[model samples]
Target chain A: MEMTVLIGLDAASYILTLLLVCIGLVIIFGMMNVVNLAHGEFFLLGAYTVVLLQQYALPFAVILLIAFVVVALVGLVIEELVIRRIYHRFLDTILATWGISLALKQLVIVLFGPGSQQAVAPFAEPVAMFGITYSSYRLFVMGMAILITAATFFILFRTRVGLTARGVIANRQMAACLGVNTRRVDRLTFAFGSGLAGLAGAIMAPLMSVDPQMGVGFLVPAFLSVLVGGTASPLGALWGAGIIGGSNSVVAAIWTPVVAQIAVFSIAIVVIRLWPGGVTGKRKR
Target chain B: MSGYSRQLTVLFWAALIASPLFLDGWNLGLLSQLMIYGIFALSLAFIWGQGGLLCFGQSLFFGLGAYAMALTTKDMIPGIPATTLTGLGLAVILPAVVAGLLGLALFKGRGLYGAYFGIVTLSAAVIAERLAINWSYIGGFNGLLDIPPLRVGWGSWQTELYDPLPFFFVVLVAALGIYLLLLRLERSAFGTVLRGIRDNETRATFLGFETAEYKAAAFAVSGAIAGLAGALFAVQFAFVSPAILGFALATEVLIWVAIGGKTVLLAAFIGAVAVKSVENVLSDTLGQYWLLVLGLLFVVAVVLMPRGLLAPFLQLPLPRALRLSGSKEE
Candidate 1:
């Protein structure tokens, strides 16, 4: 019973992390149509930021906030310089972003060396609830990711900016004609998406090994999540992430972890063939 | 101008055929590798330039071809032929089958656009690599080595392909055959319909042309050629690995096609050889900085010579060169 409880808590934490990353991807790919293959790099940047800030003996909350702001600024710069030009040509954007990803990876290698850096977790204790022992850091990650995802949904569904962004996604020309300032919206949306990715990276740093190539392992799954969750819908992102995360956890518990990843991709491909609009149905107008 | 162009073609073929005789053994080997990659790049051009389908997973077909050849050469099953001919046959057939099935599944969803197509194909390549790595039967990460050289006969006096000369000739013949086949296909009615589809898919659909079928056919043809190249690669390296299906290989082929100028098949071949030769020379000198150079080259190519290196050669203002073509009209 104790082992089962531990497994369930671990699974829940993993699902929450997947949910946060997928939410960021949905905003970037679904709303912006800017297939940022370098989304993982943004996550890496956030983690590094936290590591750098923590070295100065900053509080965990301050480190997280600084990491978020700095990474979001980097996202804005990338949008203005690189992504803006290739918005109309989707394939070109993918290739260019891949180039950026490679460059970012090399940059990280240059800065951090070719070794994995250990991220120090702020909370040292394990929290026990109902006979289940879970790391405090993991519980913190779950709470933060859930809160952020909820806040994002609220802003996207209720705010004027979100409505304008939605209009632009639905019909760019129509949105422009209505004086929506689609260009500004594009930049903010990209930055916001990247910021979320960065936040995920910072949050996940304590759990996983941080290295130059860490982003590569996560990139495909994030893309799989985006593809399986209709490309133009937020609810789809959540559903896709939940399915992938849950299945992966269960399969990994039963079988090998590598097999579980392969199963995730296979299931994604099968799901795509069966429901091209994704599991969340069509995008809402 | 047309006569001059014909003369140039003649000169090019003559140089290509005589190159091995003049070049050293290492150069000959490199040339053979380039020729194989040339075939791979041309396969991409057939789909991307002509068919308007930007398939980022061409490496899947290439790796499939290599694995097929590797498997056949190993004669995994006792009764299967261990000859190079059998290797080549399976290489062509397997990729075609895989591409046909994949194309059917992917081409159905309102085209899926270019980015999605790229992502899906990339995902497939990653999955394939992972599967190969996990399954030791396929040789895994270390790859299959010590593949025997091709033999032409059963007993004494059989020709061995261990030497670079024989291998070069084999690649040349295969490349020539594929080029001719592609040329013929380009001139056929089917080719016309494909070009029509590329230019305007909806209009072609309205005209009763089966756009999806034509795209699938083109994709299959591309896969077949890529597989043939992969087979040649296996023989040349005497090895097979999952790296052949990697994103790096796929992107390199794209760069070759882009640099060569996708307007003509011959241009793609020239581009592939030229780019590989330059990289080989640069890497010998620059070492780790080679990728940095390549990244810069990609950027320059996109910004400056969008049509690729061939554009300047074909369109240069050489005094009366531009006027030469119109002279006959005058």
Candidate 2:
């Protein structure tokens, strides 16, 4: 019973963090209709920021914020420079972002070498929960993920910036006509998405091996979440994350990580085949 | 095709044919490998340039072809024969079927357009790569090794293409065959219709054409061609790894085609050869930084020069028959 509860808690944490990691992708690929292949690299940049800054002995929360800011700034620069020109060209955006992905990967390898870094997680103390001892750090990560998820939901549905962003997503030309500064929205949306990716990277750094290729490992799973969830709604995304992340975490605990990967993929393929539109997908007829 | 483009195409082939005369055995072998990649690039050039379906995970098909060849020739499968012929056939067929079905599924109903299709393909490649890495039967992360080369003979008695010169000709023949085939298709009415669908699927649908079928068929043909390239790649490489069947190779090929001219088959082929050749030289000097250079070039190719760097030299003004009536195109 105790073991099952612990496993359940772990699974919940995994699902929540997986959602956190992929929400950025959801915003970029789902909401913006721009396929940012470099989304993973933003996450990578975030993790590497933690790796770089943890040496300064700053607070973990401060480091996470810095990671978000740094990556978001980088994203803003890219959006302004390369992405602004290719907004109308879907295929070109893919190639351009892929180029960015390659550059960022190489840049990391050039800066950090190919080896995995040793990133230390904060909050080493164990917390007792219902007669069970759990790592407080893991719990903290879960809390942070939940807090961020709630905050993102609040901002997206509640804030004026979010309203403006959604208005742009709905119709860029219309938003521009209505004085929404669609260009600014595009730039900020991309940066905000990238910032979310960075925060995800910061949180996941300690749990995952901090290598140059780590972002790629996270990318496909996030893609699956968005693909299966449908870009139509956030709740749909959450459900998709739950299915994939939950299965992955559970299977990883029970069997092997490799099996978990394969299993989740199979489930996704099956789900996709059965309902091609994803969870929020509707019939054309 | 215009006279200039025809002459350029002919000259390109002639130079390749005459290359062995000046080049050494090692360079010949390297050129052969690049030719296989040229074939791979042609596959993308056809489907993306002509068909207008930008497959982000083309490496899935390439990798499948390689693994098909590797498994068949190495006698790894329980029931299948281990002949080079069988390997080659399966290599061509497997990826085609997978891609055809996948295309059909994705193109069915409302249909997945643009980035949706690419992401799906990308995910497929990732899954395939992971499966290859995890499956111990296929040798896991170390990958399958010591695969047999292309053989020409009756069943029992066969001569392996061990010599680089002979293999070079074989690969050249295959590449040229694929190139010519793609060019012929590109000029065909089918190619026009494919391009029509690409330019506007809804309009094509309004014209009573099943755009999904067209896309799926184009995707299948592209996969078959890519598979053929992968099969040849396996024989030349004599090893197949999970790396070949994933996002890395997919993106690499995408870069080659984008830089070469995705719209022009010849340009894409040359782009692959040129990039690979340059990498061979730069790996010693720039090392990992070469990827950064490639990334920058890719971005430039996509943003400022969508026609690709080599398109000016390789592409010809299309004749009237290939163009839609009353449609103006440069």
**Top-DockQ candidate index:** 2
Which residue window of length 10 is worst by lDDT in model 2 chain B? B321-330
List the lowest-lDDT window of 10 residues for candidate 2 chain A.
A276-285
Q: Which runs of model 2 end up more than 4 angstroms from their true locations?
A: A273-277, A281-285, B1-3, B78-81, B155-157, B323-326
Tens-digit lDDT track for model 2 on A1-285?
A: 788888898899888888888788888877777778898899999999999999999999899999999999999999998998998897778889989999999999999999999789986788888668888878888888888888888888999999999888888889999988888899998999889999989888887789999988777888788778877766566878898899899999999988889888877866765666678877542
lDDT of 1 at B113: 44
Model 1 C-alpha lDDT versus the unseen true structure: 0.80
lDDT tens readout by residue for model 1, A1-285: 887877777678777888888888889888887788788888899888877777899888888888778878888998887888778766666666765676676677667777888889998698879787778888899999899999899889899888888888999999999988888999999888888988889988888888877777788777877778787678877877778887888888889888998888888877776666777767321
Candidates' C-alpha lDDT:
0.80, 0.88
lDDT of 2 by residue, B178-268 (tens): 9888888888878889999988888999998989898999999999999999999988989999999888899899999999998899999
Q: How many clashes would you count in candidate 2?
A: 0
Q: How much is the lDDT of residue B328 in candidate 1?
A: 30
lDDT of 1 by residue, B124-197 (tens): 88888778877788788988887777778766767767888888888888888887788678767777678788
Q: Per-candidate TM vs. native?
A: 0.90, 0.95
Model 2, residue B327: displacement in angstroms? 3.1
- Per-residue lDDT, model 2, residue B235, is 89
